[model samples]
Target: MGNLSRLLKESWTLVEEQQDKVAGYFYARMFLSNPELRDLFPTQMDVQRARLLGAIVTAVQTMEDPDRFEEYLQSLGRDHRKFHVEPQHYDLVGNALLEALRTFAGERWNIEYDQAWRDGYAVIAKKMMAGAAADTNPPYWNAEVLAHERRSRDIAVFTCRPFYPLDYRAGQYLSIEVPKYQPRLWRVYSMANAPRPDQTIDFHVRALGAGYVSGALVRRTRPGDLIRLAAPMGSMSPDHSSNRDVVCIAGGTGLAPVKAIVDELSRYNRTRWVHVFFGARDRDDLYDLADLNAMANKYPWLTVVPACSDDPGFDGEQGNISEVIARYGPWNDHDFFVSGSPAMVKATMRTLAGLQVPSIRIKYDAFTDG
Candidate 1:
């Protein structure tokens, strides 16, 4: 590694060691100096701090070579662009991080350390700007509920008419905000339906036992209910056309986003093979079974497999979805997408690794425990 790369590696290592403290000090400083940022964070400041610490630590630790690390940083920059995180925000974060280092490292902090950090910040900022420039912003979506169907006791399918023209690529998510809740809770829900410029956008929500907005969506939300939503954001879409073989592993309501991907891809002129492996607790919990069945019937290259862990009277593939997927065939031949609980995602990822599927081709979204 070059001198700059070596310095960065060392700095990142130090940051990792003091990750928790750095995260705490960083957020505290931001909230203190810039009161505006205080509201952007959750009510549980400590929890948010820890989560941020863990994410940064994971990102830094995974970065072995500087070039690869820079690529990861660029991706992060692009993701931040969707949230409108400006170049100034990087400086703010860096300042707070440096303050934490000064506090923790004490006498070791020097002019040379500051200069190195300044150089790093400049590099990061430039990369972030470049990423932002390359990003193709998805159309913003906002609407009022037009129709809703209770597919199951826990899951509800909602259709909403866009107040304005809406456009979204398959597999992207909509940030649904419930303003009624104090601090306003926002959760990303994948668009359950294909893009229709003239029609309603759909979201399939699963109830999580008084899960704030989820509970509201399930039992109380009605037609004509105004819902504020941000446009589609996420790279978990059908990006490669030539790569035909596709495998989708979905659990519970996690199938919502993947459904959009499959639905959109089915409409394409050139036929591509797709295997959807859907899982739920039981037959009663499964939604869109008929729709998937229809797709399989209509498209020669599409296949739907439903797996149930505790089938009881039911009879299908009786096991975890990942195990069932492995039993079917080699996972290496397809682009795999997994969406569910973090534990489920971890297990599915391990299964993919064992099957020799490349990590870059496998997309995942762990609905983070907030």
Candidate 2:
């Protein structure tokens, strides 16, 4: 690690213990210093606070790999365009962040730490601005909802057509802004199918009490509704170079990206065997069973297993998806794709590790804000 990386990691270790306080301080300082900027953020600040701290932590953690760090910053910079972020705003935010770190650091804050952060922030700002400048596409795309189907009480599947062509790979995700809600509030959702010539995309949304965007999408959105979609982001996708057998595990709405990968595989008529485990709490929660089964039937190389944790009467695998996957065992040779709630993903990762799967063979996009 470089000097700046070491400084950032050391300072972050101190701030992480009081992460909530530091995030609260940073936003408080920002809003207080520039009241007009408050309008650009969400009305509820809790999730936003967590997101800010998480982003900083991730940036620091990845700084050791310059290529990865630059890519992440570029993506973040491009995505921030949707929020109407301007070049001047970066300086203001950086100042507030340094102030927060200083306040939290107390006597521990030194000239070296301050200088290191300034240098680091400069590098971040330059790369982010460069990313924004290089973008040929519009900051955001206007999409009209073409279809909205409530697959279950809490989950809905939406198909939308962008006013302009949206170019993305099979397993990427897009940040969507619903104007009816907080105008600037955005949520990320995985594109649930492979890119098509028509420029239409599918998203599977599950409403959570704290998910304002998801609630609006599942309950208030309808056909003809227009929403804004940011540029596609995420690096989760199949490794086409390797024809190894694939194992996909999804929980709840996490099925979206998994379905997208499978769609791509089916379209290409891939010869590799794919084992998919779809997990739900009950039989009623298996909303996409028919479609998945249909796909499995059409693609003989694909196997779809629906596992229900609470439904004993269901005539299929009975257990949490991760537990069911454990029963199959010996997944050391297969490439694994996992998605769902953080708990589900973490649990499945543990199961995969127990099965001796190499970390490099496991792939998923866990950074998108949901």
Worst ten-residue run, lDDT, model 1?
A: 177-186
Which residue pairs come into collision in candidate 2?
Answer: none
- Model 2 scores a C-alpha lDDT of 0.86
lDDT tens per residue, model 2, 197-244: 888899999887788888899999989999999988777888888888
TM-score of each: 0.77, 0.95
Candidate 1 per-residue lDDT over residues 1-370, each given as its tens digit: 2554556556656556777777778788877887876655556454446654454444444445566556556655655543456667777776776687667666666666666666765666676567666767532345788998899877888888877766667887766754444233455688887888567788888877536667777777888777767655665787655564888899888888789888888778355678899988899777878888998898888899998888867678888887888898766567788887777788889988888888988888777422
Query: What lDDT is reached at residue 298 by model 2?
Result: 92
In order, candidate lDDTs are 0.71, 0.86
Cα deviation at 214, candidate 1, in Å, is 3.5
TM-score of predicted model 2? 0.95
